[model samples]
Each structure stands twice: as structure tokens, then as C-alpha cells.
Target: MANPKRKWSKARTARARSNWKLSVPGLVECPQCHTKKMPHKVCKTCGYYNGKVVVQSEEQD
Candidate 1:
């Protein structure tokens, strides 16, 4: 197997790893309440998904 000619510097390694980052979760508007939420998941605020109420929300209790 071919080996690297030279060792990578710490700065170069860090620069490459700097791109490894936490991205913001993709958020879409809830159709029923107009609040931001993750797509295809139950709306945390109103507990609605796919045009229907899946879980009863606290506000309605």
C-alpha cells in the first residue's frame, strides 16, 4: 500500500474537520397553526399531522 509522503499538519486537519458541523433542523410551517415544525412529524404546538389531530394538545385540555 502507498503511504502518505508527509504527515498532515494540525491546522490542515482542523481545517478539514471544521466543515463537520451541526446543521439546523429543517423546519416547515404547520398547516393548521402556521407555526414552524419538523416536516412529517407531529406538530408540537397543536399536535396535528397531515391535516388531522393525532394527539390532543394541552391547550384543548
Candidate 2:
């Protein structure tokens, strides 16, 4: 096994870590249900995707 030869500098490490952020995920409204959901994914509330129902029984849960 090998180890790092030099300790990482604070500035460099901070700059690299600066890009680590919690950006809000992209969301699009379902045309049928008018609910916010992730783009191109089945809506958890209504289970619709691409203008069609993908799940048969979802509201029971």
C-alpha cells in the first residue's frame, strides 16, 4: 500500500470542496396531475410518466 507523500494544503482542499453543494433537483410539473416531480421519472403521487399512467395502484400506499 502507498500513502500520500504530502499533506494537502488548506486552500486547495477548500477550493475543491467548495463545489460540494446541495443544489435542488430539477423538477417538472405533471401535466395530468399538476404535481411537482423529477423530470422524466414516474410521479410518485399519481404514478404518471410521459402522459400515461405507469402504476396501476399507488394511492393505497
Candidate 3:
């Protein structure tokens, strides 16, 4: 088996893992319902996508 020759430095390890933080998903408003939703996906509240109805929503008014 292969092994590292030297110990890794703290700065090097931190720099490599600096971008490991989680980022919030980008959300957009549903045009039909005007509610927050992920882009290109069906809105859970309105069951809509691209200004059209894709799924039959359960909580309809």
C-alpha cells in the first residue's frame, strides 16, 4: 500500500476544505401561484411548472 511521505499542514487542509460549506438552494417564484419554489421544478404549493399545471395538487382552495 502507498502512504503520504509527510504530514499535511493545517492551512493546506483548511484551504482544500474551505469550499465544503453548504450553500442554500437557489429558489424562484412560481408564476402561477407567486410562491417560492426551485426553478425548473414543480411547485409543491401549486403543483405548477413553467406557468402550467403538471400535477394535481391536494390542497386546492
Candidate 4:
């Protein structure tokens, strides 16, 4: 195995990690309740997916 010849500088390390950020989750409006949710996933608010009730949420009880 090979090792690095020199230690990386703090600024350089910071610059490299600057782009290592968490991106906001992609959310789209739920067709059933019109609330924001992840695309193609069941809506946590309504427990629905693709216009069908995949999960029986608390509100539905």
C-alpha cells in the first residue's frame, strides 16, 4: 500500500470538505393531501402513496 508523502494543510482539507454538505431532501406535494413529501414515497401526513392508502395513519383510526 502507498501512503501520502506530506500532511494535507488545514485550508486545503477545509476547501475539499466545503462541498461535503448535506443537501435538502427532495420533497414534492402529496397528491392526496397536498403536503410536502419525498417523491414516490408514502405521505407521512396522510399515509398515502400514489392515491392509495398504503398505511393506516393515526388520523384514519
Which segments of candidate 4 are over 4 A away from where they belong? 1-9
Tens-digit lDDT string for candidate 1 (1-61): 9998769988998898987765777999999999999998999999999998999966796
Per-residue lDDT of model 4, residues 1-61, tens digit only: 8988769988898898987866887899998899999987889999998778999966776
How much lDDT does candidate 1 score? Answer: 0.90
Model 3 TM: 0.65
Give the top-scoring candidate (lDDT).
1
lDDT of 2 by residue, 1-61 (tens): 8988669888888888987775888999988789898998898888778877788674545
TM-score-wise, the better of 2 and 3 is 3
Q: TM-score per candidate, in order?
A: 0.70, 0.64, 0.65, 0.67
| Candidate order by decreasing lDDT | 1, 4, 3, 2
Query: Alpha carbon lDDT of residue 13, candidate 1?
Result: 89
The runs of at least 3 residues in candidate 2 whose Cα sits more than 4 Å from the true structure, single-residue gaps closed, are 1-9, 58-61
Give the number of the best model, judged by TM-score.
Answer: 1
